[model samples]
Target: MKPSLHAKIHLWIMALIILVGLGLIAQGGYMQAKAHFAQFLIERAFEQTLVDNQPHKPWSWADTHPVAKMRLLQHNAQGGQQPLGQDLYVLAGASGRNLAFGPSLMLAGAGVGEQGNMIIAGHRDSHFMRLQYVNVGDMIELYSATGQLQVYQITATQVVHETATEVLDQTESSKLTLITCYPFDQLAGNAEYRYIVEATPLV
Candidate 1:
């Protein structure tokens, strides 16, 4: 049977909408898969850095190299750290480009494993997603390229306004400050607040 002109137009519009919806889904899937695998390459690069004692780029043409490795931990009965197995590769610089691949060390702050505050920043959705789960008494570890381990205990956490640059200030004692966009579950990347995790080295 021949369809009416109005019915043919309706069918065409519906087909176009379906195609657009499918395309969106496919793109989203691709991104999720990409993020899942990209971290493996960064992890591998970190291993080479440890062995070579030099900066090893996760991939050719990347401006950043793995500078340190971080792991979450819990305190055991003996007050020793029990690894949570949440390893993250810390990149050389905290620029937006570098943060896309992994949490990065802010160049303006103290060097990793140094005696001053070291600020690391990552996207709330990806590398820093687990940061939201950290507690005040939990332990965190950062291992340098030479395999030197620095242990710290989480001291505090707060949500600060986006303009609160004071959080990046240097501290009298060694500290680890992790920053991520606030409201972790929000779909917007440019939130007006930040989630800060402050940790002090364990004696």
Candidate 2:
């Protein structure tokens, strides 16, 4: 049977709409799955495992403890080549973005209770967008299989140059330094400045 040109055009439009609908569905599904996987990883990293009323071995960064992976909290500035699911130490701020040179190895360092500063870097985008939201007295917590470590408010924010080593200076107190891209508006490439958020142990 010969169909009119209008019928053929309508059929093509219907097919195009169907394909677009399918694409949207697939994209939604993928995003949902990724979110679920990220949550799972965070939970697993924070999971509690006990041994003889103490704690399991794999939870800490001592004696071959498995590295705890981190996930960006969406809107994170640091873009990763891998999706949020792959088990890698997710950078939370500039350090996470500058994985090669910055504090990407923080997880492998002293877990939480050691002396000296514990610096962590993540992108301004996804990981530490909350930096601006952080108030002077707010509390930040880091979790691992062993237990959760709480850090109290110290300095909520600062700005430094990319060439400034003072931001990474050694501190007597157990500190956590989070770095991220600065000026927030420059999205083309790496910026010349950085934003730092430093916190101290509660006690």
Candidate 3:
């Protein structure tokens, strides 16, 4: 049976729409899978850094590597009991690709455990997602390649514009600064503000 011209055209349009929908789904799935794989590799490299006591790349061809390990401890309201959280890999630089996988230390700032302000940044979606749960008086521990562990207690959190530089100010005393995009739940292509977590060395 020969179909009418309009009928055939309608079927063709439907098929085209279906094909486009399928393609979008496939691309979304692939991106999601890739993101997960990247995170896994980043974590593996971080573990390698700890095991080797130095910077370690996730893959031979990768340009970024893990420079330190960070752990967080949250205490109860009573401040009597402390609950430890996951260990995160701290990478060397905050390039987009680096933050896509894990947290990164600002190369322009002092290194972890140094005598100046040490700035670190991570994606609010992944590595620093839990930062929202961090409270004043919480403890953060950073371990350097030389097996030196520096402990910092959270002092305050600030919400500031992305261009704010005061958070990275140099100081004589050692300080740890963690930065992430503000409004943790909002997913935007460009974030205009930042959530800054400040900590001071624990005596």
Candidate 4:
């Protein structure tokens, strides 16, 4: 006996739905794996730069280069006062492409450790996620490609409008600014503000 026309239509609809669902899942998984692999390459370049004191690109085709090494110093939670954790590699120029992999120095600012504002920016979800936990007086170590090492202590954290360029204004004293999109957990299309962390050289 032949199956009814309605039964055949229902079976076809179910098959289509399952195919679409599987495609979505596969795409999501592929994107996640790609992101992780990119990060791994960036970190490897950062370590190589530290050894050679030269700009190192994460891949042969990559335009971004590692410019500095940064480390956050926080006291141990237990009995000891010594700081823990490893160093991070900072990339040159905070363009959208450069920032996707790691923190990047803004080319418009003064050189790192120079007598002006030196700005760095990172994605709130990745490299800069720990910035919110940074506290006043916490020391940050910056190792430049010129074999210069400097320590800066966090002085304040503030929220500013995305258009506010005052944070990038020149200063007589050396200052370092770390910037990230505000509302770290937001999934909105455009971020309206920025999270700013200001630090000054430790005398």
Candidate 5:
């Protein structure tokens, strides 16, 4: 039987919808692959930076370079802590582009291993997700470009409004302030509040 014009139009629309859906799925897969590849390159650059004792850009056009190495440790039953996972290479800037790659050091605060509060910001969904399990007494180790390691013990975890800039304030003491969006499990990003992890150097 010959198909009516209306039936043919519906068929075309359905075919078009399927094509669009497939395209979207393919694009998403491509994006994920690209992100993983980029991360691999960034890690390699960090290794080079450590060996050469210099900044190494992850990519040719990248504006940021690996500035430091960071690790988060979890408290064990014996009153000791063990490494949670792999060490994260800290980037130089806190710009969105840099944060997409890894935790970024905010230039507004003191430099790594320097006096005053050294602020580091990262996306909750990515590198800093482990910060959720971090509690007071857990330890954080930050290595400067010179491969100098500074150990800090977690002191406090606070939730503050995004407008609160006091966390970024310069202090007479050496402090490490880690910042991420609040509500770790929430799907909606750019939350009104921020999850802050404050740590002090271990003498």
Candidate 6:
């Protein structure tokens, strides 16, 4: 006996559904593998730029040594609260929360002593997500591998369009700027805005 037209249609529909499901799974796996490879590359680049030497004098930013990782802590400026930890990267021309630019990237510059803004940017998801919790008058501590510690107090916070360049400006004083995607809870598309936490050196 031959199958009816209705039965044939049902079989076709089931096959189509299975094919779609398989396609989605394959695409997901591909994305996962790609992300893993990208992370590996970033780590390798960070290791190559790690600095191991300390500066001879204090209160100086002249040494151009690179550090593998720097610890950033965000705390209340009143000196009575705990701080959040952030991963540090050394790169040039790095702004915003994008980190796929490659290794040897310096958000601003590397030195032991100098009065210049040492801007730092990290992803809102993995590296600097906690930045959203930072408030005005918060304290930020940047610890370098060379035993050099730079402290800054959060003086300002703002949400601006992703294209805004004012946040990346070079300042006369040694400053630190933290950048992350705005609207932390949003799940779709770019946030269209960036959250900036500006800190001035603690004297």
- The whole-model lDDT of each prediction reads 0.89, 0.53, 0.85, 0.83, 0.90, 0.60
lDDT (tens digit, per residue) of candidate 1 on 1-203? 99999999999999999999999999999988887677888888889988888888888998888889999887677987777656888999898888888899998999987888899999988889888887899988899888999988999999999999999999888999999998988958569999999999987
How many pairs of residues collide in each model? 0, 18, 0, 0, 0, 17
Rank ordering of all candidates by lDDT, starting from the highest:
5, 1, 3, 4, 6, 2
lDDT of 1 at 70: 93
lDDT of 6 by residue, 118-177 (tens): 666656665567778778876766555444667778889899998898777777767777
Strongest candidate by lDDT? 5
Which should have the higher TM-score, number 4 or number 6?
4
As for lDDT, the candidate ahead, 1 or 4, is 1
lDDT of 6 at 137: 73
Sorted on TM-score, highest at the top, how do the candidates line up?
Answer: 1, 5, 4, 3, 6, 2
Candidate 2, 9-89: lDDT as tens digits:
999999999999999999989977865564454334334331222332322442322223432222234542222222334
For every candidate in turn, the CA RMSD to the true structure comes to: 2.5, 9.4, 3.0, 3.1, 2.1, 7.5
Give the TM-score of each candidate: 0.90, 0.57, 0.81, 0.81, 0.88, 0.59
lDDT of 3: 0.85
Once superposed on the true structure, which residue ranges of model 5 sit more than 4 Å away at CA?
Answer: 2-7, 76-80
Model 6, stretches more than 4 Å misplaced? 1-11, 22-26, 29-41, 51-90, 95-98, 101-114, 123-128, 137-139, 143-147, 162-164, 186-192
> Poorest 10 consecutive residues of model 6 by lDDT?
55-64
Q: Give the winner by lDDT: 4 or 6.
A: 4
Q: Write the per-residue lDDT of candidate 3 for residues 1-203, one digit (tens) a residue.
A: 89999999999999999999999999999989987787678777766666767777787887888788789889887856364556787888889978887899999889876789899999888779899998898998888865678888999998999888888888888889999998899978699999999999987
Q: What's model 6's overall lDDT?
A: 0.60
